[model samples]
Target: MLSPTLITVALAAAMIGALAGVLGTFLVLRGQSLLGDVIAHASLPGVVAGFLISGERGFVPILAGALVSGALAGLSVQLLRRGAGVKSDAALGSVLSLFFALGVVLLTVAQSQGGSAGLTMFLFGQAASVLRADLLPMAVVGGTVLLVLVLLWKEFQLVAFDREAARAQGLPVERLEVLLTLLTAVTIVLGLSLAGVVLMVALLIAPAVAARQWVRGLAPMVWLAALIGALAGSGGAVISAMGQGVATGPVMVLAAVALTALSLLLAPERGLVARWRRQGAARQALRGRQVLAALRGLEGDHATPDYASDEAMLQAYLGTDAGPALARLYRDGLIRPAARLAPEAAARRWELTEAGRLRVEEGGQHA
Candidate 1:
């Protein structure tokens, strides 16, 4: 029941999302997320220039123009950092603002001349404009990016995790860095039509971030990120198709963000909920140990191996609530009620069991 146009848009968005997700893993790991933003915003002038030169909104020319502009922006940042003695952040900021301002000015001129109709869609994206014919090129480019990544997997991994170590091992760190940047530029250009210049960075970052929460290894992270990105893209496209006036790019971004939030809250071992549970368990363990140590101290003070202390005595010694800790220790067979109690004793007393004494001894040794 679906139309061919809607299907094509969905496929295109999915491909773009997968590509962005894969490339974004490296960028996020390297702390170069701003680089994606720089490339995305800086490519705008190239898009306008491509349209101006071709006098049409052709994908090839526009893609070529954007690649060149984005590559130049990347190189400019490097040159500023090494040649001009500027900080990395400063160079990126400068190049991003300069290229984007130029792009805005060029877009204004093109609009005034009345030849830039529909070209403005790249600013926020218009996935409905994608045609079936565009799918082949996107597939080819995306395939090539994946192939190159596969071939250079180990080298890229080395560079991403430790550039100095890679260099020390005689790897071409600079060339690898440039190649990664180029691949990123290509991915960003491919995504411009689906997510647009403004929201493209979100598509790049959100999926990778979400994947990171669920994975620790680079390989699994890349695979998961690609899947998340594709889902966001396709889901957004379907939602946009169902709505009357919704935009595809924003919807896709929102979907990706939602996925990220879910990952942050629910992923095992790394999510916020998981972390809170671990912290709570750790506190409980520490409290149990503290209680055990307190019982041992009370026995030592009385010069009696079976000396027993009531809950009030433990609380007074530890200056905190001891009931929960005592109950947990008792549950674990680490402590027990004293064997003997005076007839007039108002409260029952507790003593450390053999297991509890051994646990305290082990903790002391480790400490």
Candidate 2:
């Protein structure tokens, strides 16, 4: 029984997630994660400019303003990269501060006029503001951005992973980069209406960061990021509905952060816990092999037994020296005590079981 309002918020948030899948890949690959922050800050000026020109606080005009300002912000970054001989860090820092200042000034003037609605929401974001009218442009831009990212997946990866190599192979790295920057700007503009300028920033990049933790390559990362973003979006909407006066934009951001944090701790290959477990498992396997070898030499047994037999021999062969490795091997089923053997040597010879052999050869316990 989702209220229409909740339903709308959830849907929009999910759509936002889908949008982030594309935008995140580009940002991460280009090493421009901070650019999302820069563009978010820059959108203040864009919003004001849109309001100034449109003389009203409509969605289209505000988004248009956002687009222009965002483009300028990106353009400034490029100028720094190519023309000013400045690094991206310096360029983004300078432009972010400068554009934000201008935006603040204009916003002050606009607020002083005192007749607009939803103006301040741009500073933090207000997801509850989403309406049917806002969806059209967002749908168009979000869809287009996603579509382009999919179609140019190879090219984007080329630009992202090895720009020089991609260039050597004659890929249009420069043009594609420009397109990506513009696409980021457009995404910022679309997000502004719902998340506002400052808060929308988080939604832009958090899902992608989360996706990276969960994946090895670009495509999976993009898709995962989008799923994360969408879940956050919908979750935020639902929360805002239940909690009175909750801010939509910030809620969405928090959701993205939660997903990212979860990914860091839980993602299969790259997560902290997962990696630790894998390493531990590997070490265990190595230790098991060593213990078996020690017992094998001690028992004068050279290979005619299963893991269980190996365990039995190990107990007697190494005696007190069978050690922690011997115990672990038996516990993990890599070895066991042989029962049907000579009364004198039944418990003292070691051997590798099928699994034990595989473990020894695999090179990694996790494998």
Candidate 3:
């Protein structure tokens, strides 16, 4: 019970999201995330050129223009770094700003001219403007890109993890690098109508980052990212369909960001809450051991049964929070308050019970 327009928009968005997510994983791992953003921004000028050339927003012309612009931007980053001795980040920034500025100028000029109705849609996307004809091309491009990604998985992994090692292995490192750049261009160009060039980087980065928190392996990460991306895309489309003036691109980016936040807070091993729990447990365990060890040392000094260590002594060894650890130790029966302490001591002292002493002895032996 979905409208055809809704279905078309959802399918196209999902396709674009999957492509961006898969490629974005490699970009993230390679420490070239900014490069993807640069490519996206660079594609704007091409989109403008396409609109001008075709006198309408034809998919093929815009895509071709974007691909060409995206490729040049990718190459410029490398050439700037290698040939001109510029820093990598500086080169990416240069290309991103320069290309985007040019695109903006072109866009402004196109707007001043006639026959540019809804052309600004490429800036932030006009999901409602998508047609059923767009779905097939999106599917074809997305499937082809995925096929290429699967085929070059190993080569991409090698280059991403260690480019020097890949080069040493004679694996055509330069070609792999270029291949990745081209794929990145394709992803950026393909997503222009979904999120637009301006906001497309969020689609590329957020899903991969969210997936990274939940997995350790590259392939699993890619799959998870793709799923998250697809969900974001389809969900955004559905949500936008419910409202009269809802924008799909921002909604999709927000959805991806929501997934990232949830992953950061709830993912089992890498989540913030889980890590805090682990650290708290570890500190509690350490404090318990410290208290036990203090008791053992007191016993070694001939304060075994009658004489107990004072809180002052324990606090000196542990920090100010020793009170909680001491309370826990006593509650656990690992230590007991002394029946009698030296009259000179003002604070209550502690001594290990027989069970506590044996436990400490066993721990020492193991260590």
Best by TM-score: 1
lDDT of 3 by residue, 246-311 (tens): 999888888888988999999999999999998888878877887788778877887445457788
lDDT of candidate 2 over 1-367, digit per residue (tens)? 8877677667777787668656876797778888888888998988888888889988778878888888888888887888879988999999999999999999888878877566878888777678766566678878888788778878888889899999999988778888888888887777775687777778878888888887787778777887888888888778767788888777878888998899899988899999999888887666666675564444345443343344444556545455577667767776555564667653454455566556655643431
Best by lDDT: 1
Query: How well does model 3 score by local distance difference test?
Result: 0.85
lDDT of 2 at 21: 56
RMSD in Å for all candidates: 2.0, 5.1, 3.1
What lDDT is reached at residue 317 by model 1?
93
The true-versus-predicted C-alpha distance at residue 312 of model 1, in Å, is 1.8
- Cα lDDT, all candidates: 0.91, 0.76, 0.85
lDDT of model 1 at position 206: 95
**Of the pair 2 and 3, which is ahead by TM-score?**
3
lDDT by residue (tens digit), candidate 1, 82-105: 789999899999999999999999
- Lowest summed lDDT across 10 adjacent residues in model 2 is found at 299-308
The positional error of residue 93 in candidate 2, measured at the CA in angstroms, is: 1.4
lDDT score at residue 216, model 1, on the 0-100 scale: 94
Prediction 2 global C-alpha lDDT: 0.76
Q: What is the lDDT of residue 367 in candidate 3?
A: 10
Cα lDDT for residue 308, model 1? 87
